[model samples]
Target: MSTATDLAELTARVRAHLALRHPDSPIGDLKTLPGGHSGLTYSVTAGDARYVVKAVPPGQRPVGRNDVLRQARVLGALAGSAVPVPAVVASDDRQPAWFAMDFAAGEAVEPVLDAPEVPAGTARARMLEIASVLRRLHGTDIRTPGLGAPEPLDAAGELARWSRTLHAVPAELRPGGEELLTRLADALPSDGRQPVLLHGDFRLGNVLCAGERAVAVVDWEIWSVGDPRIDLGWFLLFTDHRNFPHLGRAVPGLPTEAELLDTYRDGRPPLPAMDWFRALGRMKMAAIMGHNLRRHREGKHHDPDQERLPPTIAAMIRTARDLLA
Candidate 1:
């Protein structure tokens, strides 16, 4: 249960933990996994068994508590579903607050997104593959046991949820965020469909792709029951011109908003008022970034890149406003 700052200490702890839960397995070749803003990940081999351990940093308090346990629950919920998630092995919320899952081998699509040019066919295929995975995830029955009960969401609740958090942001950043939220609330979509489970942070970086196929969807901190279109909106907005105009030139292979929607909907009912949902997505990002900025200022989680978040928040606010206009 003690925290380990060095690999030697961590390896020893892993050996002890394994001896208790998995007596026959002996630890070897332990290494830290990379690439996540929050949570520490480690890869270990024990008697030919390979798995990953995800741990919350000692004093790091995420926006809504460290969600390692929730993440474990989510993986368990998706057990028999088509969605690809790492298999959870063990978890505990003490001291280090960690969980273990079968290790997935693949690179995240995040790096591919940074490529300046991707062959047209490759780009289209990758886009379709990603969209297919999303389609399956949403299609999974939320009424299943391990998955929590579905919670209905509407424009008002979404606004209030982010508004409460937005209030704490610096006064200078409040005007734009508030204005954008007001516009979103006014234009809220009236699509009358039951809520479906949503992958809250659905994006390239969050998905692990091996050989052009999405092998595993990582990071379940914000997953919840909500409007399914919001997931699509979130993805489309990232590629939208206003959000990051330079991205198209800097990084090719991104599907157009129309293409992604078509693939996701897959001849099902058409999405309702995409612009409004996209604006909401932008506002959500703004609120999150603003919250992170506040945390940075308060020295809650010391990240050097957090120094660059204010302008990003401002840009997101502007993009949200423009989406409404």
Candidate 2:
């Protein structure tokens, strides 16, 4: 799949698969779309319509995050809801499961984000809009994303889930992972907040924005029904320069964490144990970075972007410990 010939073959397969779905329509070439958290994302042109196809890699297992059908199912559930998500067009359950959704007309990165040459003004309003969107997303019926009874996880369970992944990475890169996990497990939330639909890796990066507004929330690979704070805390940390080093420190235009929380709360009861959730979120990011960093080093999946994540692994642990303190 590295050579031009291989890409052409894959493109043909994608075009053929989609042809059956739109039998009478003149299907066009599959243009490779770059930069997504997971799965193979491509933009296909068919007649006057444009579609984004999310598919599991050709030779990999389609379970867990690679399961494109799971993402599509959640998108289908949230399609007509208040949440802004690309409308699901179709899904296929064959080997290397894949799904199609209408291509969102927006940039994946927010203008106010920590990148250069990217416009930066709507940062405040856009941040609040994100909070409002989260409120609607969490309000979604948890059962809609489930195959059967949805298993809702709290702090300890969520930590355990990521622990399994961290174990696959090399030990040297994750010095404080064990201790952090222990601390998070011991200090589980006492209030027992109700679970809500969580965009497990929610952040400005996962949002698709049109000008100052978020038009769609993409990358549903790690979505789940879990404690709401898991999503909120991770998202908030990106705005804070002290945590999530990948976001850098140029985000002064964004709203403060307090402001974001107040906006998300709307009229509902105050969110409980957010500090602990934010700590857990850091730990989760550390695990993800460590695991992917290891994969990158091993040449299992070569992406130079991961080369810089090693520092973030340590930063995440430090931030988690500070939050826990």
Candidate 3:
């Protein structure tokens, strides 16, 4: 929904914010980056330095301050940790609603459902490496003030939250999601394990890779402290496509579901409701895609990339059903 004028206003505001943060640096050409349905991202160059700026839409700002502050806090904590996250520069929760960080220079590892030309062994190794990073993140203790919080959801809480999200979609767009949700709810695993800080959305698209190695992980809007299985389940839901040819290309030799679950367990107690969490992840994705499709159709926002949502939602529903079966 941004126009030339909106871009101008955003640029001016970004310049001001940068000046306040770094008075000695000179900002250069500012260009809007693509991808993301919720907010606008810009790649700005100041002198020889490059940074990425993410800002909320005007007139549609979040109910509270910019959520990027939370992202900054989390990434800052992972600074010396094994997790590969972008470097934080400045974050503000006030007007202009933006955060600036050192732009990670690498291609985002999306289209992970498609099989790559890389050797299957290499791909599997990389996937395992990615898994290792996620494991470390899930294992880390979030004890910092303002950063640590109780688990976002208990087993019952997750069911209620995802159920509400599914019901929020218009009845016509529900597809097969409702049935899948019902099955998931009734089949909830009772021996759920301890909760930890979850990445919330740990799919391949949010991760950046250089050749066979993951360089940085991006997109932290949904990050929170929750069941570690939630993160694992989300990853599996996105990558485990049995019918798509691209799936083979995306993650060659991708770990089996059992292997991922075992990796997550790693000597810890078993999660009783792991399947339910995975189903919840699929349902959440379906709802999000449905919502975005609705937004685009209603002319609230016109994102060309989101046009794929309808079919994807259908596919997600099918996957969720299979998980329950």
Winning candidate number (lDDT): 2
Report, for every candidate in turn, its global Cα lDDT versus the true structure.
Answer: 0.71, 0.77, 0.71
**What digit string (tens of lDDT, one per residue) describes model 2 on residues 22-117?**
788888876778776577788988777899988777778988878888888888878778999998876778766777889889766543334532
Q: List, residue by residue over 1-43, the lDDT tens digit for candidate 3.
A: 6677777877887788778766898977568787664576789
Query: How much does each candidate deviate from the true structure in C-alpha RMSD?
Result: 3.5, 2.8, 3.4
Instruction: Give the local distance difference test score of model 3.
Output: 0.71
Q: Give the TM-score of candidate 1.
A: 0.83
Model 1 deviation from native, Cα RMSD in Å: 3.5
Tens digit of per-residue lDDT, candidate 1, span 1-325: 2244554555666667766767877677567776655577778877878888876666665334366777787899897679999988777665556778887886655423354344555555666778888999888788878777547665666667777777778867545877776787787777655677788888766777776777888888778877777787787755543464323233355677788888888898777778777877777777777778778778987776666666667777787788789
Model 1 local distance difference test score: 0.71
Which of the two, 2 or 3, has more lDDT?
2
Instruction: Point out the higher-scoring one by TM-score: 1 or 2.
Output: 2
Best by TM-score: 2
